[model samples]
Target: MAVYTVAQVKINDGERYEKYRERFGAVLQQYDGRLVAADDNPVVQEGQWSYEKIVILEFADLDAFNAFADSESYREIAAHRHAGADSLILVAKGR
Candidate 1:
């Protein structure tokens, strides 16, 4: 099954988050994952939304997603994201 990751993010430190962004593409290329969408300013249809950005990613499968998300390389860069922003991530299985 295909897998998708959706993240709602609120940035606290632009510099460190930028560092994660800069290295993300290269690291992602090493796995079966693709960046699907990223929006810094998205119009909320309803309810309150406090996040500054929304990101979406697609992977070939759960294992592929894990390969990327659990990799040492990703963990290294994710530390920057962790320090720079607050993020809520969700993984969904696609039919």
Candidate 2:
């Protein structure tokens, strides 16, 4: 089964966040990740969730997802993101 990582982020520093974005894209590519959704505009249609950005990344399976998420490249960029924004990440196994 495939796996997905869903992230909701609220960026505090746009300039710094851009650097994280660039680095994150490189990490994703290295792990053969496919971005299913990456958008900043989100309509609050049903929930109380107010997020600045929403991202969904799909991987071959749970193991692949782990390899990418736990990689040093991702951790380095993740630190930048932690300093630049508030991020909520969730990982799920696709049915």
Candidate 3:
């Protein structure tokens, strides 16, 4: 099954975030992950939204997602995200 990663982030450090953005695509490519959607201002049709940005990623399966997300290379890069933003990340199985 395909898996999707949905991340909602509020940036606190532009420099760090930019660093993360720079390296993210290369890391994703290493694991066959695809950038599905990334928006700084997403339109919310209903309910309430609080995050400053939203990023969605797709992977071949749960294992693929984990392999990419949990890899050491990604972990090294993710340090910027940890320092730069407050975020909510979720994984969902695509229908």
Query: Residue 65 of candidate 2: its Cα lDDT?
Result: 89
**Residue 14 lDDT, candidate 2, scale 0-100:** 87
Report model 1's TM-score to 2 decimal places: 0.97
Estimate candidate 1's alpha-carbon lDDT, on a 0 to 1 scale: 0.95
Model 3 TM-score, 2 decimals = 0.97
User: What local lDDT score does residue 50 receive in model 2, on the 0 to 100 scale?
Assistant: 62
lDDT of 1 by residue, 23-88 (tens): 999898899588999999988999998898999999999999999999999999999999999999
Write the residue-wise lDDT of candidate 3 on 4-54 in tens digits: 999999999999999999999999999999999999998888999888899
Model 3 alpha-carbon drift over 4 Å, by segment: none
Q: Estimate each model's TM-score.
A: 0.97, 0.94, 0.97
Instruction: Report the candidate with higher lDDT, 1 versus 3.
Output: 3
Give candidates' CA RMSD values in order.
0.7, 1.0, 0.7
Clash count (model 3, backbone only): 0
Q: Give per-residue CA lDDT, model 2, range 31-53, as digits (tens).
A: 99999999898777886986789
Question: lDDT scores for all predictions?
Answer: 0.95, 0.90, 0.96
Residue 67 alpha-carbon offset, candidate 2, angstroms: 0.6
